[model samples]
Target: MSEWRIYRGVREPHDGIDRLPDPPPWRDFELSGEVTPFDRHADALGDRRLPRADAYKAEERTIEAVNTALYLRRPLLVTGDPGVGKSTLAYAVARELKLGAVLRWSINSKTALRDGLYQYDSLGRLEDAGVARELRGPTNGGPQVGERGDVVAEDVAAAPASEEAHSTDLGRYLRLGPLGTALAPYALPRVLLIDEIDKSDIDLPNDLLDVFEEGMFEIPELSRVADKQSEVRVRPADHGARITVVHGTVRCHTFPFVVLTSNGEREFPPAFLRRCVRLHLPAVDDDERLRTIVRAHLPTAAEDADEVISKFLSHAASGELATDQLLNAVYLVSRTARDGAPSLDRLTALVFQHLNVTVPTES
Candidate 1:
């Protein structure tokens, strides 16, 4: 709800620390739409159900890698097991930097590089064209030019010719995907979350190399008409936000702060790995993580949080839980218990239970 602040108290000394650019080198950007700071709308940065954005407990190494990526203009490749706070890192950076809402591109087995760049609604455009043509004038039922009918040539020419129809404008039907939107020539670099990229097809990671290197891409659909038109307004990834591009190409003014997260489901190519600033996220130190979750969410249950966190850690030892599970357990204890009662063993067992682990039956 408030402006997010990153805790730099646990700062780590990184290579080339003294040489880091002030305000980053890539600050000269062209604004495509309204420029708003993240603090102005911090509530929309992440899922409201989970208040994890403000409580991102970053260690020295991650912050260093993030800075290195920013300075070098390389994507930050964050690898970790499920729920180790890999995806959350992007939101954290965007919130800290006052970058607008993070553009998220979720990956799956069928995902490809283009899936993140743009989505062309060819069918929708065609359907809309048919409707627009009819609205302009009756397609078949119109009488001869001299004959009086529901639609007349003069009326059609005078009324519709002056108006621009979305169907006729190919750019109108175009929607920039999260990646493409982030690449728009905005004054501030957008935070892009390439979530769970390892789940994508093998070629997906390789396919992004060219676009990443070039820092721009062309919309072939719009390019076809670019010879006659210099500028075209198209929809960006953000709802209701449109960007105008010269010659139908979207180039990044400031290379996007790309945070690519992988759950270690698959290995990337050597070439891809070389271009990225890799960060492996291990499970956070228990005491710190516990304190973070408790302090941010359940301050009332402070006295009993350590005991609850210990139970959660014991359950997580079997490799079937996530950090959020501990949060859930702690939040529940904070709510269900009024007085700091340590007699929540049964509740902890229920909350922290992993489905894969066989629970002993009553004898």
Candidate 2:
């Protein structure tokens, strides 16, 4: 039994992560004593996506695997069927550890590595340059003089100076994505959820290897201007917030706790798998666990949830059904049971339908 766990799975906020031992030499970043600016978006305590403290019940194995990933400073690759709590695991860990916010990067087939890193608004910058040029007007025409013999057009030069500064401001055109924000040099590690990596392009997994190992990334737009301006303030994934990037590079003082989820949609490359700690979440098959989950989300309906759970288990045994379907059935039954609704049976039938099975309908 592994008792040296930092994330205890109890859903109570604690600083046990402070007790974690130093990382292996190969994984050490050596960026100690760096100061991170206060980010209200990352430090806020309330998140609607987080599971209720009293309702989520994580298995012992899940606890051990998370702690292992934390100690090793590696990402956790969670594979499981739908509704198996794979994605929710990241939020659970963030909530329990008092990690500010869970930065999420949702993946699709077109999602590239840079999509998670940062976005540069080149087109916007070009448009701003055009506006600045118009404001400066033509220098070819002789300077327009005022009624008192002062050059009014010369005053135009002063105005466009501010516009030229605005046009060349690289920070206004660049914003850090979720992955980039997670790599900011925070004293406490941020929780980063890379959801559905299996849905990404074939090369995306390979592209992330360098970033995961190095704990830093460079922005080319800012890099080109590094000679003139070494520090630039840019927005993070969280709106209305700004962070300073020095020398066009963003590095982590503390390695972030990363969770990559998959729906078993596709296989990953062997090299990519080698760097991540893996965890497979089995389906929620136990009757007691189902009740606990229901109670956590909807306590008022839990008293009569036994009957719904039994039917849910019976349907689950025959075909694939998500845990949320069970919760839906329980909520509807508890709400409509007092009315003696005659359509209760039909409603439950629709709620518990197998995900993989298709039923014929009338034309």
Candidate 3:
């Protein structure tokens, strides 16, 4: 895939945001193995997937919050209603940071730290082992091909193959869930987005607080085995490998680009909020919202853009429609237009149908 594009048009507004001082050469980062730290890569920090200025509605406040988090090296808490792009902020940060990977831990009632970081897929591993055994065993040399495939009794006795594959600490193969994938070592810093923290149970957030605070976790799978002290396999994010926990515990080897989002539907513990730099995203207005949809989904300027946008704006103004549904309507209308131009009536009908609002009748 092509490298992610960062639009210059979006970044021109924040032309004067002061950048942090360059780090010393001694602070360089090495993801696969420890290396000398250096400031040479400092300039590359904060290069994320989304342009810093793309968030046009809350340009100043958003940039300030992001810059603050970068400078303070703290977690940013983005709280807002759904579809307001709260989680997208993390993507913006990842783009700015120039980080190749972002660890996303989507929080829900069933979520746990273990679920986010790494959970071994036993089924996949078992399937792999079974296939390996079938491939490696016997090349049909049984009893000289059993005299033209007639005498199978002696062929069966040639070798008693074991059906059971050696059991692997299957969990050791714990594929880094989105969380673990983010933490996987990389030449660039990784963005770790813990989305919808409010959907999680009380204990889930509390559990994550510890890991984020410490900046690491133990991959008992990656640790030094008692017998294999010299053998250590550290998997890079691009490659799939399980971490083994050795002496002490596996801690966050590198501080991740962490962004935790919430819909603000539930309140978090004070201590939870204390560690994070919280930013509440207010609702975007009609004009700003329309512009956002235009920029995000209709970059080519579909002919029906204005009409679709106006309908959605009216719906939003009357509190009868959701921002996403509005965007979806525009998307479908634009996609179905025979020549990239939808008629006003068609656009209006789609809006009314999707938004579930009845049009007023003329008396």
Per-model TM-score, in order, reads 0.78, 0.88, 0.64
For candidate 2, lDDT tens digit of each residue in 95-114?
A: 77777678899999999999
**Which predicted model would earn the best lDDT?**
2
TM-score of 2: 0.88
Model 1, 1-363: lDDT tens digits are 111213142222112222434433443344364442223244363566225656666777887788778767789999986767888888767665556577899989998777888987766655555566666666443322222211112222322653334434667667899999888876556789999888888888889998887788888766756775667877887763577777878887677889999877778999999989999998654776667757765666667688878887787787577667777777777677477655578778767777456878998
| lDDT score, candidate 1 | 0.69
Q: Show model 3 residue runs off by greater than 4 Å.
A: 1-58, 121-172, 184-188, 221-227, 234-248, 320-322, 332-363
* Per-residue lDDT of candidate 3, residues 1-363 (tens digit): 112222122322221212343322332222344321222223234535343224433466676676565545467899876667777776655444444335567677888778876654545544555454465576453322123322112223323354221222333344556665554443334567888888998898788777666655665533433243323333333343444433414444445557888877789888888878878876666666566656665566545577677776665666545455656676777676477666765665665453344568999
Error of 1 at 109 (Å): 0.8
Candidate 1 vs candidate 2, lDDT winner: 2
Give the residue spans of candidate 1 off by over 4 A.
1-50, 135-159, 163-167, 338-343, 354-363
How do the candidates rank by lDDT, highest first?
Answer: 2, 1, 3
- RMSD for each model, in Å, please? 7.6, 6.6, 10.8
Ranking by TM-score: 2, 1, 3
What 10-residue stretch in candidate 2 is worst by lDDT?
A: 149-158
**Which residues of candidate 2, in runs, are more than 4 Å off?**
1-3, 32-34, 38-46, 52-54, 139-161, 338-344, 359-362
Per-residue lDDT, model 3, residue 321, is 54
